[model samples]
Structure formats: C-alpha cells, structure tokens
Target: MKNYILFFAAIWMTVCFCSCDDGRIYEQKVDIARGGRTLKLTGRFSGLSNWADGYSVVVAGFNDKSEYAVITKSLPVNVADGSEIVMTLGGIGDEVTALKLCVVNRLRECVVDFHTIESEELAAVTDTIMINAGTLDVGMYSTIQSQVFDKKCTMCHGETGSASGNLFLTAGKSYDAMVNQPAHKNSDILLVKPGKAEESFLHLVLNRDGDTNMHHLDLFSEKEQLSLKLIDDWINDGAFLNNK
Candidate 1:
C-alpha cells in the first residue's frame, strides 16, 4: 500500500509540472506571434450632428496603395457632443502601412481622413501605442466645400478667371452666395432653400433626374454619392454655416 501511494503521488507531480510548462510555452508562442502590438486612441468629437446618412466614421488601417481599408472599426454616432471616445486596435499586421481616423462611404472608401499614423510611426511602436487626437469638429458643409466644390467645381465656379454664372465657390464667399440666394441660371428658384433639399437648385443640378442642365449633373459623377448626401443633409438641416 505504501509503494502504491508513492507511485501515484509521483505521477500527479509530473502531470502538474508538464501542464505548467506547456502553458508557459504556449503563452510565449502567442506573444511572439502577436509581437505585443496595439494601438490606443483617445479623443472626443464635436459637431456630431453634421454626420450625414449612408456614411460612417471609422478607425481604419490601410496599405499605401489602396483606398480601401484593411481593417475598420465603426465609431459610436449616438453619443452626445464631447463624449470621451476610447478605442483600441490590437494585433496589427505588418501589411498595414497606416492607420487613420476618417469617414467612409457605404462602399468602405475613405471620404476624408481627419488624422493619420504613418508607416514609420507604426513601425516604431514597440508595444502599446497611444494617440491623443484632441477635439475634432467634423462638420458636413466644410467637407462638401473641400471634397466637392474645391476639387470638382472651383475651376469653373471661382478658382480662376471670371466666376461662371457670377457665383464664387471660394471659401468665405460660397455660403452667402448660395444660402437663401437666387440661382443665377434660373432666378425663379433659390440656390439653396434652407430646410428643403429638393427645392434647392444646387441639389437639383446634382441630381440625375433633376430639372437642370445635364452638364451640371455630369460634373459630379454617380460615384460621388457621399458628396451629394452631404450637400443634401446640410440643406435639410437649415443649411447653417456652423452646425454646433
């Protein structure tokens, strides 16, 4: 009986030791595979109301060549203004060249990049990376001006030579020129009638079926739905210059 008891105790000790050793080995392997990489973001968003439909704000990782995101996490939209935002992107892969805080359209294409972490910065991260993006005001009208009018319309509208239709889309002049003002092409309709997108001539010219010159609709292609929505929502929301 004494011999039997000693044999069983020895076997139990061996099993326990093996289990502990295996656990340590597994943990080490996992750590090596993961490289202890992580990204932590802390910030607050202002002008939350400016976010339009069919678009989402996201924290995304991307490669240098593609506009499409490699990995993305949607941000909370229902939260009140100035609410603390805490997010983490862990186990980042080597192929991911950059990380950005931006708005993406329904197709997952980045519409605008608000903040970015370049590849060099990402490569230097040893363990946990921390980013404190101070208050961001993501207003829609500003986005429309930069992404739409600035890129697509400035040439004919106001950037150089005579302003076509006597309208200036240049900054500090566009708002007063469009809001509550009559369209030069057609004096019967307002350029942008606050609280009504369909009634606004600006929205009319952008719509494919709207009552305007076909050339106006061709200026912005169908792929630019995000830009169209921004303009539409801004008008629907009273077309305010500052939506705080």
Candidate 2:
C-alpha cells in the first residue's frame, strides 16, 4: 500500500505539470489572437474640412469586391491643423484584403481612399504593422471637384463648349464660377453663398425637393450622400477656395 501511494503521487504531479504547461500555452495563444495582430497608423491631416453628421473619416479594412468596410475606427476630426494623429486597428483577420485611410458614409461605404495598404503588403506582416502616412490633405472642395464635379458634372458643364446653365465645373474654373456667383436660373440666388448652405442654389438643386426643372438628383447615386453633405458643409464654412 505504501508503494502504491508513492506511485500515484508521482503520476499526479506529472499530470498537474502537463496541465499547467498546456494552460500557459492556451493563454499565450488567446493573448496573441486578441491583441497581437494590429495595424498602427501615424500621420497629420493638413486641409481637413468640417465633417458633417452622416459622414466621417476612418481607418478601415476591406475586401476587393465590396465597398462596405469589414472593420473600422473613426479618426479624430476636431484636431488642430498639422496635429500628429495616431490610430490603431487591432485583431485584423486574414480575410482583410486591404486597409485604407478613407472617408466613409453612414452606411460604412468608402467614398474616397486617401491611403491604401494592399493585400500583398498586408500578407507580409506576421505581427504588428506600422505605417507612416505622412501628411494628407482632406479638404472638401478638392474632393468635391475630383470625385463629383470633374467626374460627373464636367461632361455637361465644362468639357463641352456649351456649358449647361453657363456653369463650368472643370478644374481651375469651378471655384470662380460657383462661389458667390449668381445662378443663371435665378439671378437672386447665389450658386454657393458663403456661410449659408440653405441660401445656396447649388445646394438646393442637388436635393430632390428643390424647385428645379432638371432632375439633378439623378446624377448622384445613393452612394454619394456623403459627397452631397460635404458640399453643404463646404458652403456653410464660407466656401473658400483653399481651406489651408
């Protein structure tokens, strides 16, 4: 009986040692899975415009086929000019094809991408990834010109010799043609009245309920609500040619 008791005690100790070792291994894995895989972003925003209620800037992960973000974290918009910003996105799964610093609408759709980390680059990361984006300019008017006017409106307005409503939305000419300029349809209303979106004819014509013969609302899809809001905010913020 004494011999049997000693043998059993030795086996118990061995079992306890193995159990503790396994527990430590499991905890380490859990910790890694929870917080080890991360992407850190550091940069300063230069020409940021006023962000509206439904629109925001964020660091997000996405796949190739979808516009909707898989994971996202909102960036601070109230920071002073040239303030160094640091943001991190943790627990990034293998399914993420790309990571982007971009403007997103309320539906989490990426409106415009300011910076991108491609899948090939992301795959190289075994652990934490650090990226310095340098300085990004996120002014609303430039974004509006590039994304909306140049792409959508210039064909009818500036690209053709016969500009619609005598408005030219092409680059180098759009700012002067719109801001504080009188609308051809209504001489009394300004195309973009500084500090007042409600009084701006450009804002009014973009909306569905606005009294206009032309269905300008059709030009912008459901995906462009953020763009529309940006225009309104730009007008409300004095419609400057340069926010810097």
Q: Which candidate achieves the best lDDT against the true structure?
A: 2
- Clash counts for all predictions: 0, 0
Q: 151-243 in candidate 1: lDDT tens per residue?
A: 888888889956888989987689999999999989999999999999998888888544787467667656566667768877887788865
Query: For every model shown, what is its TM-score relative to the native structure?
Result: 0.62, 0.63
The digit string of per-residue lDDT tens for model 2 on 142-195 reads 667877787789999979776988899998899999988999998999999999
What's the CA RMSD for each of the models?
6.7, 7.7
Candidate 2 C-alpha error for residue 232, in Å: 2.1
Model 2, position 13: C-alpha lDDT score:
100
Candidate that would win on TM-score:
2
Alpha-carbon shift of residue 129 in model 2 (angstroms): 6.8
